[model samples]
Target: MIQGDSVTETHQGILKLRVSSLIALLFVAAAASAGCSEKMGSAFAPSAVEGVVGGGQLQFHDADTTSTATQGIASGGKKARWDALPESEKAARKARMAQRKARWDALPESEKAARKARMAQRKSRWDALSESEKATKRAARKQRKARWDALSESEKAAKRAERKTRVRIAK
Candidate 1:
């Protein structure tokens, strides 16, 4: 009977030690996880060098990107910095842009055909609308314009961004 009593006491002491060890391990793990999370936070945080400083203000700046990373900014030549560009170079760019615009303005047959089809479709849709439906649409447009005019600048910016995102996704 005395031996049996000693065995029970030993089991209880073993259980207590196991529980205590588990608790200590949990605490250590929690502390380690917290330290790791803090380190990760700092790692992802933006550094001071990632922005432009002007008038004691820091503005975030993104690096310029080209479609072909290996290619230079123009015809495998280094891009001239915008602020430091020579007047002659600027004039040449402007002339090139004007030439491109002129070429675009000379419409191709395919574009003309597409434009005609679009106009025809728009006319047909307009003809299909009842007078009451047209009135309703006009009222809706006025309401939308009023609502847009009432928006704050920041809200308008957000709305424009949302519209651009929608257009991109649609394309």
Candidate 2:
């Protein structure tokens, strides 16, 4: 009878051990699945990965670092090195930029489209010009620049005023 009881106690112990091991395995599986969910970018939680992810590039953005958009490379063509420009050129460039911004703001979508189309047409025509024609245009441009450079400061100011007046009238 004692032997029979001992056998029954051993069987119960084995059963308990199996249950504990199964519970441990289930917990391990759950923890592993949680890791997988993190990698998959679960909607319930924010993704661990940051920055722009596309085009086979993995950029990691940190709090102190500026975004690629602000650096002006991937978003569009490279920006001009503003710090390298002469002070005289910088003011003129700034004024021209402001004027362009104002003009762009004032234009309706249709007008903007028309302007873009006109620019495209002009570019196509320029591209179609023969090599000799291109050279002639370049020579004419150089001559105009030389003539402008030869003018006195007063003459240059007059020319600028005249150009401004012409532009205002055209607008």
lDDT by residue (25-103, candidate 2, tens digit) is 5644554566634346432222222222222222223333322331113421223456667899889999999999999
How does model 1 score by TM-score? 0.34
**Candidate that scores best on lDDT:** 2
RMSD of each: 30.8, 27.3
lDDT of 1 by residue, 61-162 (tens): 224422211111231124436546888988999999999888767988689788788789888998699868877998999999999999999999999889
What value does the lDDT take at residue 170 in candidate 1?
23
Estimate the overall C-alpha local distance difference test score of candidate 1: 0.57
The 10 consecutive residues of candidate 2 with the worst lDDT sum are 51-60
Best by TM-score: 2
Error of 2 at 116 (Å): 1.3
